[model samples]
Target chain A: MRPSKLVPLAAATLVAALAAFPLSVARADDAGDHADARPAAHAVHDLWVTVQQLAGGDSAAQHPARPAPQAVPAGGPTVNLSDLSHPPDIDAKLHAIARLPAGAVRLTVPNGQARLGDYSIGSEQTSTGDLLVLHGNADVFGTLRGNLVAYDGDVTVHSGGVVTGDVLAIGGLVHDQGEVDGEVRTLSAATPARTAAPPLSAGALVARNAAGVVGVVLTLLALGFGLVLFGRPSLEIVSDTVSHSFARAFVTGLIGQILLLPTFGMLVVGLVLSVAGILLLPFAVAVYALLVVVGVVGGALAVAYAMGETYTRRRLARGAMGSPNGYRYLVVGLAGPVAIWLAWALFGWVPIAGDLIRGAAILVTWLIATAGFGAALLSRAGARESFAGRIIPPEALTDEYLWATPQFGVPAVRRPGKR
Target chain B: MSGSRRARGGRRGGRRGAVALLLLLPAAATLHAQTMMDASASRQLHGESRLDARIDYAAGTLRVAPADAATLYRLQLRYDRDRYLPLARYSAADGRVALGVETTGGPGLRVSSREHLAQEATVALSSRVDLALDITLGATEGELELGGLRLRSLSLRNGASRTSIRFSRPNGARCSRASFSTGAAELEVTGLGNSRCAEVALDGGVGRVTLDFSGDAAGDTRARLDMTLGELVLRVPRGMGLRLTSDRLLASLETAGLTRRGGAFVSPGYERAMHHLDVSLSSTLGGVSVEWIR
Candidate 1:
């Protein structure tokens, strides 16, 4: 590869690696002493001190550009910038600064003897307010009473310069030669750290996806539990219906779904046409919704229960456990369906496989829900003895033989014995 | 009884039946020959400044957007000609335009699945003129984008369809009232604040309904929502004050960042807020979820 192409490739690889394994890199760096650590710590400490001075109202003045007497101890406030830079206070201050008006001049370093360009702050200036240099360089040769901010630029303080406040360089370098007081900070121009938008770490992504999956699983489990608790018998009937006539129930459910909207519309129109029907519209709608929910929930429960029963019986045949009850069946049924859904959610992190799995899960769930709903409807919401009543023949109406009854044919012949 | 007289009566009846069958054959053939076709219609604004328009469509993908500067309204339709055709009429006298694409044949006409019609209508209004709109749809997917329009009043009704109505831009004039009614349809309306309406009403049945109040409104507004059988989701802007009154039966409600007062959910600092939304919700058998967004 050409040198030019290799550079870009290397950069890309580095970025990808950082994004893929940010925690590993951080841990490795922390395990060993790094040259950049000391400087970073020093800068943080200085910035904290500046924030404290400004927050304490020690540097408040009407004319921010006016020079003030330095209040420095023998070693210049022995404040560890680290100790003063509290995360909460820093966040609050940043938020306050962000809320300031766009055109408001928060700080200014005076144009002194040396005429510096628009992008540079002069050296002889004594700025009492927060000095902001936009896409420029701040060459501080004099005293800076307030915080110095160089955005997308460089800040250089000569040996003769003295800054009582914090020094911040965003996307630039901070060459501190003589900073008597306050914290000093520098952010690399290559990174957009000042924007506070870092690529999402892989760990975070995995954690988020995992949390989402867990939440969905818990919700489904709760729903299943509720179904079993409130409508156990109905759920079992629906399950039996599905087990006995899966294909029939599925086809009926599909048809019912297709016709649901149209039927509802017709009913609504009818109600609107009739004066008395209008009054019952709300009640009718409520009943319709209740029926739909029952059908869907009942159908799903039935599928789960059937799966559970089969598994349980298989285990029993293998001499695994005691006789199974409704609760056991419910657990088995819910577990199978929920497991499928959980797999779908967990594998969603994978590109193609996740989508395929999700699609399959949705298709299966819809089929089961629809079929269950149809089965429930067929059973008259579990009021009927069986959902397969249409296919099953009714039992004989009478136990006595018709021919035998007639054999007593002439009532007189039968009565002879009685007489 | 007379055999000859009975035979004569039967012959006469047979003749009448044959005549009736012969009469229907031609009509049936004509109906059967009606196939799907693409058609379009457009009208330019001549001297009219204001418009009161009504659009009635059934069983098709309906799309509505702003028209070009020169045209007032343009309609593009792809439908089974035998089943339906587009009809448009404009009256300059009262500044009223009625547009409808309706079924031509009687009910139960066999329309192949592939022959489902698609209708798109684009309408332009004079910035200087006020407007009133009424729309009705049936068993169709409908999208209406009404923005940067000087609307006076609006009403929409739909049946067994999925619809989305949006206003990306604020209204040029304040609307007195706006209403929407649907049956067994999934409906979403975004940027209600842009409607600049004093009063809004929504009536829904069977399917999901979403009302997004996420935009800068000129003043406070009131909305009344009535639903049955399905869920209702309300997206409210964080800064906008909200007060809600609900009448529910066998339905669950999930409210975020709201305090209950006198049987109503009210946002924090409701009394002092500059802009407020007062909502009255009535539902049966469905759930309601309210989300506050910035």
Candidate 2:
């Protein structure tokens, strides 16, 4: 958030203060004029500041600024939310949606996941970093991640390139030539003699979030179904096989996806047949559910398998997971997300990955689900002996993979001589 | 069974073959005889005979393993400080070996066991009755406790055997080598203080090998492996200086976190490590993984 934007916001605070306590507003106005009104070097989430002001009312206006403002707590913020778009433009809509106060504020986006159709949207990386959005007029500052879509304001993309999704920051500052993928549009707004552009909204954020959570749950549900059907380690191993074997998973998943279109098409056609063959109509629906249940079951098995291997090696070796009963899948598959979500809820309330933690978890789950589904299709075809059943320990790999480095200096002998 | 009815031109082997046929009840017994012959004498085997020894050695060059067992037995040579020819017709015995290998490491001699173990001990050796040769090596290079020594250049060919090799080191070090073959009988060379072998190979068949080379004494270490079938694994120090190169046939090599010096520069990770190793590893069948740790 820039200093210029803060000036009006500061004045807006004064106006609201004046309306409430008249006497304190007078005193603040006088003090405001006397003091050079230097901008606060550090900015907080704009929405948090807004909610603080709204809740605090007039007395807070005269008081010194909060050392650290806060965003909405876990239960979610209390907003005077309107069912319809209030003020109608992107800027006002964003303001209305976020409801930040007139001054410097901090806005931390929820990293929660959502699911839309077959796609899992939102962060699944259970990290601790939050996407903190500082307040400003046209151009915004602070960390931006995930889908930063539809901002009519000319925002400067920073050096820290956005990893995924679209970038649409219009009017004032596109100074930072950061990466952008999706559509970006710009329009001039007339009224204010300031560099204001038409405001753009992000229904996708809500849609994406909702879609992510749903996707994750559905995927998990599908996995659970498969687990129930195929039995343990076998199911889990297959699911993970797809995930770890990205190429195989993708190819197999594509086949699955391709086959699904026709299955659904057949279902649609089956509905027409059901009208005539009413007795067999029930069988059709049962078959559809059966296919879905079977698919999810298979997917879960694959996920479980991959998760198990990954867990046994990286975690059990270091004593991170300490169960002797061997319920590795139950522990890692189920517990990883919950642990991350709780951490974010507890510690994420501060800074860092708190807000973004949930999002990361969602992303991870989404990937897992995709792999699970692919695995279901693969196993159904009984390709168990298909040149892919080899278990090569990571250390033996010859290619430079994603997280591989000569650990010569990595401190492998942490406790070798202790015993 | 060695036997040959003395026909017209039959020579020394004639009587030897005749004796072999009579002792056919237990072939192993005939192969392992209760007699002593000079390393220079060409003593024909009347029956199966085996030579089990009790020895104490310094670091020298004598490679005894299963991969080359068949080849060595074919050479049947004399035993001692002479031309070390290999062959199947070697002396045999079933007895206990009592010998100790002196420690051969650097100054620290930091015996990691809080202290040192019983520096000397005795172990029994046999070929027909005993299933496998279990060898144990320790941290510091110690003297060769060769209680069971028979073949001049012995090679072990086992169908399926347990060669449980154990090693101890003051420095908590572990190193091993394997070539690209499976079902190659396992041979554990224990008491690392005084042992020397440039290369170790695993040819074919099913086998489990355990090696403990926990010392920096060896000048330059190199392991060559050629596998056509079955599983092979080598666990060593993660930080140990190594040069790995691979020619993949069917098996996928995974070297996730091994510390090595020279080789086709593989981006430090599992895939590259597996690919760049100079092992003749092909997976026409089976799988293999090599782990490094110190």
DockQ (Cα-based) per candidate?
0.01, 0.00
Q: Single out the weakest 10-residue window by summed lDDT for candidate 1 chain A.
A: A70-79
lDDT (Cα atoms) of all candidates against the true structure: 0.66, 0.39
lDDT tens per residue, model 1, B55-86: 88877677777776555665555555545655
- Model 1 regions lying over 4 Å from their true place: A1-419, B1-34, B108-114, B117-128
lDDT of 2 at B131: 20
Model 2, B1-294: lDDT tens digits are: 334444433765677787887778588754542221111101112233343333332222222222122111211111211111111122234422212233324343322342122122222233222222323222212222322223222123333333343223221112233222224445443422212233445555544444444433243345555554445565544344445566665456666654554653223543433222224344434456665545
Q: RMSD in angstroms, candidate 1?
A: 27.1
Tens digits of lDDT, candidate 2, A1-419: 99999898877865664455544333333422212321232112223334456556522233433222223233333222111111123334344534334243323345522110011011222112222221222122233334332222234443433323323221222333443332222222322223656543344344544555556545665555555455654564465456556667757666766677697678767777767554344456668778776665556445655565566677767877565322455445655655554454444434556458867866765655566667666666234623245665545544353236544554543423322
DockQ-based class of model 1 = incorrect
I-RMSD for candidate 1 = 32.7
Error of 1 at A388 (Å): 14
For candidate 2 chain A, the 10 contiguous residues with the lowest summed lDDT are A114-123
Q: Candidate 2 - CAPRI tier?
A: incorrect
